[model samples]
Target: MKLRLWPDALFGRLALILVIGMFGGQLLTSTIWFETHDHRTLEIPSRIFASRLADTLRLMQDAPDDAARRELAAQLGDDHYTLRWIDGPGVAKAPSVAQRTVENLLGDVLARRLHRQAPLHLMDAELIDDSGRHRGIFSLFDSRMPSGDFHVQVQTPGGAWLDVTGQEGQAGRQSEPRALVIEYLLRIYAIRFVAALLFALVAVRIAVQPLRRLAVAAEALGKNVYRPSLELSGPREVRVAAQSFNAMQQQLIRSIEERTRLLASISHDLRSPLTRLRLRTEMLSDAASRERLSADLDEMDAMVHTTLDFVQGVEITEPRHQIDIDSMLGGLCDDLAETGAKVALEGHAGAPVSGYPRNLKRCLQNLLDNAIRHGGSASVRVQDERESVSIIISDEGPGIEGKDMLERVFEPYFRAQPGKTHGSGLGLTIAKSIAMAHGGTLVLRNRPARGLDAVLSLPRG
Candidate 1:
């Protein structure tokens, strides 16, 4: 599998971007500081040590003899440096890079004090050998201990050699290596880094809260037309988007209400005319023509009534609740059995789904009616999935006999097999509308073995 640096969710993507940006910026600033300021600060310790070395040289030159010089050196010695009198010019071993740099700095300072300079070399001199014997020594070499001595042979004008030695014993914490400085910086600020990351997480969450709430409200709106509109909050952009969405929702609700009211008025007004037409048909003397006219009038009246019912169903305003779909299907089958219909139920829903009880029941009722009407017997099956629930209702009669007629079956007033079934052709249409209103889908397919199957799939939450 390929590695994915980016996530699919908005929250994860935004958080990842924020963390990378913050961490990168911190790293860049620290690198710049270490280069420009941190390394340059190492010169301070070198300058202080150079000044003390020059003082030791000048004081030892005024000593009267070897014993007096040794006494004076002892008096001037400190924890960092131990002054002593020795008889050597310099050490035989070559100086390392670090040792050479220290030697150059001290030689330059001493030459400035003496007012003349050719080349000055400092060497090791064992004067005060009271080296710190740290117990539990772990190093392999005993000669390579922490003990160090600086021996300087200054040629006196009287042709005698003045061996001045200084032993630097104690280690100063200030003169640390570059890597050690970086390590200290990291250890000291590790907690601060964690705290800053936590702060970024919280800030990102607060910034993205509006989008999260908007998504939840949009999903709710898809499931329920009567869901309350979202309140405006958060950033300006998010607030504007929420306002636009709410406006669109209000316009849709208004349009649907207007259409429903108009259709209801038309249905009500035409009822009296349809009744008068039925009464007028009775006055006809021809018996065969009267029966035909009355039948047509009755069919028209039923169509109008079914149309009104469909319109009312579209305006459903039921609240969502946990519904046990299996129990509902069993109850519906029982009711149909009482009505002497061969309607049976199979399978079960393992859990309850959140939905509008009345609207969902009505949708199921229409599907079951279709199954029983088109086919002789109806079998309803409820399937529970991980993310969704399904209801498969099938019948034993012949399936849709005509091609291109399956989708047309859901069109209002467009019956595919006219005169074969007593229906207004609005049953499937209303059922599908209700299913969509509850964030579900209804599909119709012909079963090759027997008849038609209606599948209703609803989301799990």
Candidate 2:
């Protein structure tokens, strides 16, 4: 069940690969951006806030008196910034890990701009809800401000602590600012990500569309080799494959036409000489010589006729039709039974097949003849398979001795049993051709129990 759920088609697997690759690429890009850009989110805002504190201290130091400094500090307090003065050292305890990091960053910025570093403490801002309750440990941010906020306190050389409070800019208070960074990342790149996903889907579909067309064209070729050429599209490799397949199909058609033309020409040319030779043999005075010559001429004529018939029948351009294979096999069995041959038909097919009925029959007749000639008796069974139909013809006589001759027997004029008296060794060859012409196969095997088995498997159209 697990294996079955896995993709079996090219489109499915390719789509899977494309999806994984594209998503993985997006995630990898996001990770790199996160690692490289994280510090900028906190560093710029913190330094600017720290610089503001340094500027405020300088403003206070330049003031005419402590009372005027207090007034200036009060004036600095507004919506976005709050400033206050504290007596002696403030936050007289150990600072937090986050506080240390912010202090170092702010200390460096202050030293560069002010020409000296001041004692500074940075810590979390008091968490506020919409209801204005102090939720110290909890944050309002889930997907937005997960890192939260902070407040800073810098002590001046005058022994007074200057309180500076503000956010870390739009980036937020938390040093990491994970949620805000993620949201920012999404806001910036979401459309591009979606567009990339769509582009990949369409591109993959376009790529696979050509292969599907090629597959359809191939199946059509099997049905009729003379089918129209495939239209070229898709990637370079796919287009090349389509072009090659179409060219091969054209070559096959030309080859078949040339072979048929050659056979016809040979048949027409051979008939005239054979006719003249028949006349010459009839004129011979010696009865025994005349009979022998006549016999030789008859054999030659029969061989030529059989070869022509085999070619013509196998290559017949008949339109395919649905036919009951069982009835056809039954009829052949009846005809052979009339001649006292021990032939029997068993089993049946679920569906009729589309084929050249006459050619299909001729192919069956050849197998039956081979079985009777070599095995003395034949048992035929028609089996229905998922994708094709099998017509198995087994014989009871001696099976072929040469294991290597199984496929060779289907080659023209190549005899399986060379000493056999009844054939021109073209029966299996013709059978194989007829089967192939209908997009089928004819394979001969030595039966395990005894004798030989000739199995003809034809695709169901």
TM-score of each: 0.62, 0.62
The candidate that wins on lDDT is 2
What's the C-alpha lDDT at position 341 in model 1?
93
Pairs in steric clash, model 1: 82-167
Q: Alpha carbon lDDT of residue 305, candidate 1?
A: 84
Alpha carbon lDDT at 443, candidate 2: 85
- Residue pairs in collision within model 2: 149-173
Q: Per-residue lDDT of 1-461 in model 1, one digit per residue for the tens?
A: 98888988877777778777877777776655443332233233344545666665566567776666567667877765654444545554675444465567666776787565524555532212234443211111222223334555554322344555444432443333444555646753565577667877788789989999999888767756678888999999999999998997898789888888888898899989988888889999999999999988888878778878998876667677999988888888999999999987778888898888887888998888888887877998888898889999999877886657877877888887788888788889988888888788888888978888899999877
Mark the regions of model 1 whose C-alpha exceeds 4 Å error after superposition: 1-9, 32-37, 52-198, 231-251, 274-303, 324-327, 348-352, 384-389, 400-419, 445-448, 458-460
Worst 10 residues of 1 by lDDT: 135-144
Per-residue lDDT over 284-355 for candidate 2, one digit per residue giving the tens place of the 0 to 100 score: 999999999999998888788777776776676667889788889999999999999999888898888878
RMSD to the true structure for each prediction, in A, is 10.5, 10.0
